[model samples]
Target: GPKVLQIPSHQIIDMGQMVTLNCDPVSNHLYFYWYKQILGQQMEFLVNFYNGKVMEKSKLFKDQFSVERPDGSYFTLKIQPTALEDSAVYFCASSVAGLSNERLFFGHGTKLSVL
Candidate 1:
């Protein structure tokens, strides 16, 4: 797997606050995704992006959550007025093509702790 870097390895925020998780995806990779893993739970897909649009997102992607990559900068996931349920480890992944190719590379993950 390619090495993807996630900034601020850990984050602690209170309920109803906002938090942004940043990912420096693989430079050559185009498609990007975000997955969440609660402690002791399975990793669940949240959203995927390509070009400049969100290709797909799971039901877990709440209305308060948004994803964007402006001017080819870092791919970011923003959660506003986050709930305690949002506390999880967010993993960023990227692939040159789509997930069908099975070439996804993942970051170490940003641990978000919502109190």
Candidate 2:
């Protein structure tokens, strides 16, 4: 199966620091997405990017969180000044659609613990 690969399954960071999560998706896929999930809570949409621009961003997307796909490569999320509430499992996903039509393929997820 062609699934997204999230590097470094777990991260422990201090409050008010920075961390980056990496995702490797299907080589030909164009759209990239990130979802955040906390224990006992439903997954919350974070951000979606396409064609080198951010298509949408949820309220959960904090100012400290940054996303990029440099050189059309890996989809990455960088969270600086991580807060305790930011400790959650981030699932990386990809779809082959532009706006109205899309199907998500989700990865296992990378768990981040901000202490």
Candidate 3:
């Protein structure tokens, strides 16, 4: 079975700092996506990337957030100048295709806290 793993189950950071969350997606998958869920809110799509460029990004993907593969290694999401509102459970997901893709497999999530 395919699986995605996220490191640092919990992270606490001060405001205005940079944070990079790591994700190890299923080996055979190509498309990668990031989603964020604030406390008691529905999960929202942030961005999707494939073939070295962003395929789609939602309004939630603010200017401070970026995603990259960087040599087929772990998928990473970096947030620079973090804000209080950035605190949420970040989930990493991957799929085989974009349009016809089925349900995404998500990691447990990395809980981030910004103060």
Candidate 4:
């Protein structure tokens, strides 16, 4: 598995506030992804990014959420006017290939607390 590092292990924000989670994925990986997991629940896919574009996103990825990796910098997931339901542990992952055949490497995850 590749190594993925996510900054700010824990984030606490008020409801309707905005937040951005940063991930430093494997340098050579071609695909990046975000997943959300609530306590005692399974991890749910949010979105995947490749070649500076968003390739796919699940319904869980609300309109307020955006992702980007400017100039090959940190892969980021930003949420504006976040809701209380948005609170969860966000996992960042990367792989050499697409979601189907590649082995994904995941970060520990950034826990978000929206009050």
Tens-digit lDDT track of model 4 for 30-65: 899999999999999999999999999999999999
Report the C-alpha displacement of residue 67, candidate 2, in angstroms: 0.3
For residue 96, give model 2's deviation from the true position in Å.
1.2
> Global lDDT of each model?
0.95, 0.90, 0.93, 0.95
- Give residue 25's lDDT in candidate 4 (0 to 100): 96
Better of 3 and 4 by lDDT: 4
TM-score of 3: 0.95
Q: Per-candidate TM vs. native?
A: 0.96, 0.94, 0.95, 0.96
Q: Give the poorly placed runs of model 1, Cα more than 4 Å off.
A: none
The digit string of per-residue lDDT tens for model 1 on 1-115 reads 4689999899999999999999999999899999999999999999999999999999999999999999999999999989999999999999998858467899999999999
Q: Which residue window of length 10 is worst by lDDT in model 1?
A: 96-105
lDDT of 3 by residue, 32-82 (tens): 999999999999999999987888999999999999999999899999989
Clashes of 3: 0
Candidate 1 lDDT (Cα, whole model)?
Answer: 0.95
Which sequence of candidate numbers ranks them by lDDT, best first? 4, 1, 3, 2
lDDT of 2 by residue, 8-105 (tens): 89988899999999999777788999999999899999999988888899999989999999997789999988999999999999987755666788
